[model samples]
Target: MSDQLLQLLFTGLTLGSIYSLIALALVTTFKVTGILNLAQGEFVAIGALLAISLYATGIPMFAAFILAIILVAIMGGCLERAAIHPARRASGLTLIIITLGLSISLRGLALLIWGTDTYSLPAFSQGGPLIIGGAVLNPQSFWILGLAVITLSVLYAFLGLTYAGKAVKAAVINRTAARLVGINPNTISFWAFVGSGALGAAAGIFIAPVTMSTYDMGFMLAIKGFVAAVIGGLNNIGGAVLGGLLLGVLESYSAGLISSGLKDGLAIIILLVVLMVKPHGILGLLGERKI
Candidate 1:
C-alpha cells in the first residue's frame, strides 16, 4: 500500500479501537439490563475531564486515570440504583427514554462543570511518530492498540472464565432462572453498568489525547458507538469489535477519498445496508439471543 493509504489505515484502526470500546460498553449493558444507554458517552467525557481535573490537582497521571475510571464506575452503579432500579418493571421504550433524559442531563452537568472549552491530555508516552513502510504512526496509536487488545482479552476472560462472569451470562440468558438459582439479576445488571462505565472511561482517556475532549463530544461518540453496535449485531461482543473496526476503516477511507462531512453519512449508509442485508452481523448467529 502507498504511504497515504497506510496512514489512513493506521488512523482508522486507532479510531476503530475507541469505537470498539464504546460498543463493548453498550453491548454489555444491553445484555444484562436490556436498556440502550444513550448516556454511555457521557461517561467517556466525564472520565477524560475528571482525569484532567485530578491530574491538575497534583495527582499522578496514572492515579488520575485509575481514579477517573473508578469514579465513573461508581457513578454508573449509582445511576442504576437511583434512576433505573425503581423503574425495573417498566417497558424497554420507557427505559430508553429515561436513558435519553439521563444523557441530556449528564451533558448539561458536564457543560456546567467543564464549560464549552475543549481540553487535551498529553499522550501516555513522549515520542514522535514511528515510521513503518513509509507511513508515520503516532506513539499514542500503539498505546491505543495495546490497550484495546488487553481490554478485550480481559473482558473475554471475565465473561468466559470466572464464576461471576458465568452468573452474568446466566442472568442475561434467563433472569428468572438465574434468580431461581440464587443469582441476583439486579446485581449482575448493576455490575454490567459499572463495567460498561469503566470501558467508556478507558476509551475516553485513551482517545482524548488524540481527539481532545469537550462536554458536548459525548453525543457524537455515542452515536458512532451505537452505530457500531447495530452493525455488529447488538448482542454479540465479538461482532461489536468487528463492526467498530470495519466502520472505522470505512470512515477513514471515505474521508480520504471524498469529504470529511461524507464520512458519517457513509457510516449510516453502511448501517442501513447491513441491516437490510445481514441483520445478524458478521459473527453473530442468526438465532442467538443471549451473550
Candidate 2:
C-alpha cells in the first residue's frame, strides 16, 4: 500500500480501538440488563473531565485514571438503581426512550456544571511519534489498542471463568432462569452497569488527550458507539470489538480516499446496510450460547 494509505490505516486502528472500548461497554450493559443506555457516552465525558481536572491538581496520571473510573463506575451503579431498576420490566422501547431522555438531561447538566469549554489532560504519554515501516504511530495509538485488547481479555476472563461473570451471562440469557437458579438478576445487572461504566470511563481517560473533553463529545461518541454495537451484533462482546475495529479502519480509509466530510455518512451507510442485510451482526451466531 501507499504511504498515505498505510498511515491512514494506523490512524484508523487507533480510533477504532476507542470505538471498540465504548461499544463493548454498550454491549455489556445491553446484554445484562437489556437497556440501550444512551448515557454511556456521558460516562465517558465525565471520566475524561475528572481525569483532566485531577491531573491539573497535580495528581499522577495513573491515579487520576483510576479515580475517574471509580467515580464513573459508582455513578453507573447509581444510575441503574435510580433510573433503570424501576423500569426493568418495562417495554424495550420505553426503556430506550427513558435512557435517551436521561442522556439529554445529563448532557445539559454537564454543561451547567463544567460549562462549554473543552478540556484536555496533561500528556499521558511522552512527546513524538514512532515510525515503523513507512507508517507513523503515536504512543496514544498503542495506548488505545493495548488497552482495548487488555480490557477485552479481562472481560473475557471475567465472563468465562468467574462465578459472578457466569451469573451475569446467565442473567443476560434469561433473567427468569437465572433467578430460578438462585442468581439474583438485579445483582448481576448492578455489576454489569458498574463494569460498563468502568469501560467507558477508561476509554474517556485514555482518549481525553487525543480528542479533548467537551460536554458535547458524548453525543457523537454515543452515536458512533451505538453504530459499532449494531454492526457487531447487539449484546455480543466479541462482535462489538470486531465491529469497532472494522468501522474505525473503514472510516480511516474513507477519509483517505474520500472526503473527511463523508466519514460520518459512510459510517451510517455501513450501519444501515448491515442492519438490513444481517441484523444478527458479523458474529451473530455466537449468541446461540446459553446467555
Candidate 3:
C-alpha cells in the first residue's frame, strides 16, 4: 500500500481501538443491567482528568493511571448503588432518563473541578513516529493497540472461563433463571458497572495523548461509542469490536479523502442506515434475544 493509505489505515485502527473500548464498556453494562449508561463517557473524562491531576502531584504516570482506573471503578459501583439501585424496578425508559441526568450532573461536576480548560497527557512512551510498511505510526498507537488487545482478551476470559463471568452471562440471558440458580443479579450489575468504568477510564487515559482531555469530550465519545455498539449489536461483545473498528476506518477515510467536518456526519449516516436495514446490528441474532 502507498504511504498515505498506510498512514490512514494505522490511524484508523488506533482510533478504532478507543471506540471499541468505549463500546465494550457500554455493552458490558447493558448486558448485566439492561440499561444504556449515558454517564459512561463522563467516566472516561474523569479518568483522564484524575490521571493528569495525580501525575502532576508527583506520582509516577503509570501509578496515576492505575489509581485513576481504580477510583473510577469504585465511583461507578457507588453510583449504581446510590442512584440506580433505588430505581432498579422502574421502567427501562425511566432508568435511561436517570442515566441521562447522571451524565449531565457528572459533566457539571467535572466542570466545577477542572473548569473548561483542555489538558493533555504525555504519551506512555516518549519517542518519534515509527515507519513500517511505508506508514509512519505514532509510538502511542502501539500502546493503544496493545492495551485494546489485552483488554479484550481479558474480558473474553472473564466471560468465557470464570464462574463469576458465567453467572453474569446467565443473568443477562435470563435473570429469573439466574436467580433460581443462586446468582444475585444485583451483584452482577454492580460488578458490570465497575468493569465498564475501568474500561472507560483506561480508554480515556490511553487516548488523552492523541485527543486531549476536556469536560465536554465525554458526550461526543459516548455518542460515537453508542453508534459503534448499535452497529455491532449491543448484546454481542465481538460485534462491538467489529463495529468500532469499522466506524473508525470509515471516519478516518472520510477525514483523509473527503473532509474532517464530514467524518462525524458520515458516521451518523451509517448508523441510521444500519438501524433502518439491520436493526439487530451486523452480528446481532435474528428473533427475540435477551442480551
TM-score of each: 0.93, 0.93, 0.95
Better of 1 and 3 by lDDT: 3
Report the alpha-carbon TM-score of model 3 versus the true structure.
0.95
RMSD of candidate 1 to the truth, in angstroms, is 2.0
lDDT of 1 by residue, 127-242 (tens): 78899989999999999989999989988798789999888877666667888999987898889888888999998988988887899887878878988998888877776787
Q: In order, what lDDT does every prediction score?
A: 0.87, 0.83, 0.89
Best by lDDT: 3
- Which candidate, 2 or 3, has the higher TM-score? 3
State the lDDT at 18 in candidate 3.
90
Residue 155 shift from truth in candidate 2, angstroms: 1.7
Which stretches of model 1 miss by more than 4 angstroms?
173-177, 284-291
Q: State the lDDT of candidate 2 residue by residue for 1-291, as single tens digits.
A: 687788898888888888888998898788777788899899888888878888888978888888889998998899889888899889999999988888888788889978999997755578798888878778788887788778778887998899998888777667678899899878888898898789988888878878879987887777788889888888577778778888999999998888899888887898899899988786765554222
lDDT of 1: 0.87
The alpha-carbon deviation from the true structure for residue 254 of candidate 2, after best TM-score superposition, in angstroms, is 0.5
Q: Give candidate 2's TM-score.
A: 0.93
